[model samples]
Each structure stands twice: as C-alpha cells, then as structure tokens.
Target: MNAQTVIVADDHPLFRSALVLALRGLLPDATLHEVDAFDALQRTVESGIDADLVLLDLHMPGARGFSSLLYLRNEHPALPVVIVSGHEEPAIMQRAFDFGASGYIPKSSGLPTLALALRAVLDGEIWQPPQLKEAPAQALEHRELAQRIASLSPQQFRVFMMLAEGRLNKQIAYDIDVTEATVKAHVTAILRKLGLVRRTQAALLAQRLLQAENAALEVPAAEGLPVGEDDDA
Candidate 1:
C-alpha cells in the first residue's frame, strides 16, 4: 500500500516545527510537505502533488477567515482538510465544519490528542473536541454568502479578495502577474456570479463576510477541555 501524503500549512515557524515533529512520531512512514502561506499552499496544490490531506491554519497571509478553506473545498472536493487553529470557540469550530472541514484541532491540544484526531480523520470520520455540547447552526445569510464565494473559479476567488482589499484592476494585475484586461474579465465574471452590479458592492459584501468571521473570533476564549483523550480512546 502507498504511504499517506500530508501537507502542513501554517505560518508560525515554531508551532509548525513542533507539529511536524509530532506528526513524524505519529506517521513515520508518511510523506510530509510544509508550506508557510496560503499562496505557497495554492502553488503546492496546483503542482499536482496528490496530497491525501491538508492541515490548514485559519489566519494565513493571502487568505482571510474561511476563504482558504472554501477555496480548497471547491477546487478539490475529494481532498480532505483539517483546520488547526488557535481559536477554540465552539462557534468557530462549528463554523469550520459547516464550511466542510473534516476536523478541527485547537492549538492547545496535546500531542496525543492531535494524533487521535488525525487518526479519526484519516479513517474517514469527522472529528472535533469531545467537549462540544451541540452543533451550533450557521446563519442563513452567512451560508448563502459562503455558497456564492465558493461558486467562483479559483482565479476569480483571488480577484474577489483583492477587490475586497481595495486594489484597483491594474494593481491586481501586477500582483497576480496577469494583464489588466484579464483582471477586468475576472472582475466581470465575479460580479455576475455574486449577483452584484458593481465592484464596490462586491467589496462591501466581502468586507461584511470578513467582519462577521472576525466577530466570531473576537468572542472571549471559552475554557478549553482536557486534551489527548476521546470517548473511544
């Protein structure tokens, strides 16, 4: 049988290294690839590496909130993604699952817990911390917004984010290394797909989605549950 391939995507060097070491201990025969930013991760995916899974960080450069997760879920529906984030709020965890994450691992989790969570996910089970009381439902508006964002082509998604950042078409062309005409075309498609009539409306909607996510993260950190143990363990 072939060994598994796992991509660890996180910007924090020290934590990423520790996670890699722990992953090595847990899956010694598996091939591991590391990327520090969302753009690097996108490049890795586009390179056709046949990764079995991706461990993604919630806050990474070139990605905002759940946009990265949405992009991965849209572009590669078969690939599994497990979110590893510092935020332990139940709402955030629930939101991750609602957005199609196979699992959510809080950064405070112990190595043993991390291993258990990975094992479950690799075995095709959706995993979350045992302390979660119930599944928090996502708002209907947020769900609709996510659906629209997920409908965009990968390049269109990038253009959408740049538009939200207030980058003009020329600036976006330079940053993405595409011609201005190409950017304009992407913008037109984005507007049509999102049902927005103008660029400013797209920007405002994107900002609204971002702010909603940021508010979820701003809620006081809930008390963390005991780590390294699951119901079946």
Candidate 2:
C-alpha cells in the first residue's frame, strides 16, 4: 500500500517541528510535508500534491480563524483537514468542526491524545477533544458567515482578504498580477456575493468573520477606487 501523505501547515517553527516529530513516531511509514504559512499550504495543495490529510494552523500568516479551513473545505473537498491550533477554547473547537474540519487538536494536548486524534482522523473518523461540548449559537452564525465566504471563487476570495488588509486595488493588482480593472471587477463580485454594498463593508465583514486582527477597514481616498468603491458595477 502507498504510504499516507500528510501536510503539516503551521507557522511556529518549534511547534511545527514537534508536531512533525510526533507524526513521524505515530505514522512511521507516512510521507510528511511541512509548510510554514497558509499561503504556502494553499500553494502545496494547488501544486497537485496527493495528500491524505492536512494539519492546519488557524492563525498562520495569510489566514485567520476559520477562513483557511473554509477555503480548504471548499476548494479541496476530498482532502481531509485537521486543525491543530493553539486556540483551545471549546467554542473555537466547535467552530472548527462546524466549518468542516475532520479533527481539532489543541496545541496543549499530550502526546497520547494527539496520537489518538491523528489516528482517528487518518482512519476517516472525526475527532475532537473529549472536553468539547455542544456548539453555541455563535458557532452557527460563524458557520453561516464562513459558508458565505466560501461561496467566493478562489480569486475573489484572495481579493476579499486583500481588501480586508487595507490593500488598495493597485496594490492587490500588483500582488495578484492582474490589472487594476480586473481587481475592481473581483471586488465588485466579492461584494455582490457577500450581500454587501461597499468595499468598507466587505473589509469589515472579512475582518469580523475571519477574526483577523491585522486587517483594518481602510477608507479609500476616492469613492471610485476599488477598496472603498460602492457596488455600482
């Protein structure tokens, strides 16, 4: 049988190394790949790597809260993703499961519990901490918001995040290698899909739903500019 391929996506080098070491002991025959950022993880997936499971970190660079989880679930439905996060809040774990994570392993979990969670997920079973309880109403709202964000096309999603980061259309265009007009078009589509009327609203929604701390709602200098433009298109 082919060895299972696992991708570990986390930004903390020390913790990521520890997880990889634990994984090595747990799945001795499995092939493991490591990525330090959410964007790198996305690129790994986009590279057509055959992966059996993904160990994702929620607060990695280029990701926040459930956005990466939602995006992965949407773009690669067949790939099982297990969130390995430092956020040990029950609500966060419940939100992870609600967002379609195959498993949730807190960073504080002991080796045995981590092993169990990994084994269970690798065996195609959902796994969570024993202490996790029923989902709260806030979880449902976040899940709905995630679904709406997931509805965006991959490009639109990228633009959505960039918008939240207070990036202007020209900056986003430069980053994504698209024209300013194309960026504007994506911004319009993102607004329409999210049922919003302005760029600031989209930015605020992204920050609120993703729980992104660094992203700010920047008002563009001109109403005609992309980041602050109204949904006239």
Candidate 3:
C-alpha cells in the first residue's frame, strides 16, 4: 500500500514532537514530514510531496494570521490543512475555516481529540470546535483582497513575504539567488496583484495579517512535551 503523507508545520520543537507522536498512532503507515515556518512549508509543497494533510501553526515564523492560510488555499487547493494553533479565539477559528482550513485544533487538545480531528479531515470532513459560533459576516472588500493576494505566483509571493520582512531589494535578491532587477520586477508584480500603491502598504497589510501577536511570543517551545529531533525534509 502507498504510505499516507502528512506535513506538520510548527516551530515549537516539543509540541511538534508531541504531535508527531500522536499522529503515529493515527497514521501508522504514513510518511510524516516536518517544517518550521511558512517559507519552509511553501518550499516543501512546491517540491511536489503531495501531502495528504498539513498541520499548520497560526503564529509560526513567516506566517501572518490568515496569510499562509489564504496562500495555501489558493495555491494548493486540493491539499487539506488542519491548523494547529495556540490561539483559541472563536473568531480566529472561524476565519481559518473561511480561509479553507480542513480543521482547527487548539494546542491544548488532548491526544484523542487531536486524533479525532485528524481522522475527520483525512476522511474529507471539515472540523472546527463545536463550541465556536460562526464569525460575523466578513466584508466583501476583505474577501476580494484575499482573492487578489491569493493570485500571486510562488516567486511573487516569496518576494512579497520578503518585502513584509523589511528586506531590501538587494537583500531579497541575495537570499532567493535572483538578480536585483528580477526582485524589483517581482515587487512590482506583487504590488500590482495585491492592488497596492506602495511597498509600505503591502508590508503593513502583511503585518496586520501575519504579525498580530507580539514578535517575542511567536515560537515558545511547548511545555511538558518531550523534545524530539526535527524532521525537515
């Protein structure tokens, strides 16, 4: 039988390890891949692993609230994603579903609930906390903006993320191994696609979506979970 494939994208080593441990019992024959941030998760999917599901952390580095969720829903429409987040706000959970998350699992959930959530998603069912009521109506303009951002090409998306990170054109060029002119072109395309007038506006938008929490609180190692070696392939 072909092994099932799952990607766990979380930065907390201990919690990620604990997740891996729980997942083993649920998908014993599955190939589990791990990633630390949104960029790594993007690269993994782009490399064509065809993961059955991705367990994503909402506050992971390189991701802003709904930004990564929008990108994944747009770019890999077939892939199922179950958000594994510390944030348990009903509004946040609702937004995840709106952005196409297959499920929302709070970090504090016990192993059995986690397993149940994963099983439901793998069986092609959408799962959110039963306690959460649907969020208030989202603005049409906001929905339109999400679709526009989702339309970005992978390279353009990468460039957009770098711009959000406050990297200069030359710095982005160096990091992505592209020429400065190419980076500039990507920036232009990204701005045009997002219907934005300037890089600062784009950056601010990313900040609002991706960095809602304080930067220092981004990647706390989960307490009481035993640490395990990272699996980044």
Candidate 4:
C-alpha cells in the first residue's frame, strides 16, 4: 500500500513538532510534510502531491481565518482537512464544519484524543468535539457566504483576494498578468455572484471576514494549551 501523505501547516516550530510526532505514531506508514506559512502551504498542496490529509493552522502568515480553508475546499475538494486550533468555541468550530472541514480538533486536546479524531476522520467520518454542534440560523448565513466565496473560478478567486487586500484594478491586473479591462470583468462577476454592487462593499465584506478571523485568533488561548495558534486548515 502507498504511504499516506499528510501536511501539517503551522508556524510554531515546537507545537508543529509535537503534532508531527503524534501523527507519525498514529500513522506509522504516513509520509509527513510541514509548512510554516500559508503561501508555502498553498504551493505544497497545489503541486499535486496526492495528499491524503492536511492539518492546517488558521492564522498562518499568508492566510486569514477561513480563507485558506475555503480556498482548499474550493480548489481541491477531495482533499480532507482537519482544523487544529486553540479556539474551540462552538461557533468557530461549527463554522469550520459548515465550510466543509473533515474535523476540528482543539489544541487543548491530548495526543491520544488527537489520534482518535484523526483516526475517525481518516475512516471517512466527520470528527468534532461533542460540544461543537451547529446552530441552524447562523449556519445558514455562513453556508451562504462560503458558497458565494467558493463560486469564484480560480482566476476570479485570486482577483477577489487581491481586492480584499485593497488592490486596485490596475494593481490586480499587474499581479495576475492580465489587462485592467479583464480585471474589471472579474470584479463585476465577483460582485454579481456575491450579490453586491460596489467594489468597496465587496472589500468591506472581505474585511469583515478577516476581522472575524482575527477575533478568533485573539480568543484567549485555551486555558493551558500552548500559544501562537488559531484556525487550522
């Protein structure tokens, strides 16, 4: 049998090392990879490595909360991702599930617990803390937002992210190596698909998404869990 491939994307070396050690014990035949930044994580996944699973951290250098998760779900829907975060709040974990995460394991969990969660997820079962149940009303709103974000084509998604970064059409065009007119077309499509009129409105929506992510990151670290963490993949 082929060895399973897994990527652990987190910035903190010590925590990542501990997690990697646990994963190795749980998945003896697995080949593991580590990435400390979001861009590197994206590149690793996009390189077509046939990754079986990804363990992602939410507040990595290049990604904000849910953005990277949404990107992976949109771009590589088949790959399983389990978010490992310090924020074990029901709302945040439920949002992850609504956004299509295979599992949500709080950093406060012990290695044994993490192993059990991974085992369940690998067995094709969704795993989450019992307390992380979905709230229907809030779930509907988050699901709608996730769907809207996922609807963008790869190019359009890139353009949308650039817009969120406050890039103007000319700047976006230059970055994507497209003409400004083409960038404008992408912007229009993005707005229409998202049911918005002005670019600023879209930008603000993006900003709010980012703010939510930041807030989650700021959630007082799980009482005794290590610091330097937030959202997982």
Which regions of candidate 2 fall more than 4 Å away from where they truly are?
61-67, 134-139, 167-189, 209-227, 230-233
lDDT of 2 by residue, 1-233 (tens): 23789999999999999999998888889999999888898899999879999999887887766788878987888899998877777767766776578999888889999888887887889997876745344434455655566678778888887776878888889999999899989988887776667787777777665664222223333345454453343
- TM-score preference between candidates 2 and 3, better one: 2
Candidate 3 wrong stretches, greater than 4 Å:
1-3, 34-50, 60-78, 98-100, 110-116, 131-133, 168-171, 177-181, 213-233
| lDDT (tens digit, per residue) of candidate 3 on 106-190 | 8888887887888788889998775464546545566566556667786887776766677777788899999988987887787
Model 4 — TM-score against the truth? Answer: 0.81
For candidate 2, the per-residue lDDT at 66 reads 73
**Candidates' RMSD to native:** 11.7, 4.8, 10.9, 9.3
Off by over 4 Å in 1: 131-135, 167-198, 208-233
Order of quality (TM-score): 4, 2, 1, 3
Show pairs that collide, candidate 2.
none
Q: What is the TM-score of each predicted model, taking all chains together?
A: 0.72, 0.74, 0.67, 0.81
TM-score of 2: 0.74
Q: Candidate 4: worst 10 consecutive residues by lDDT?
A: 224-233
Candidate 3 weakest lDDT stretch, 10 residues: 224-233
Worst 10 residues of 2 by lDDT: 213-222
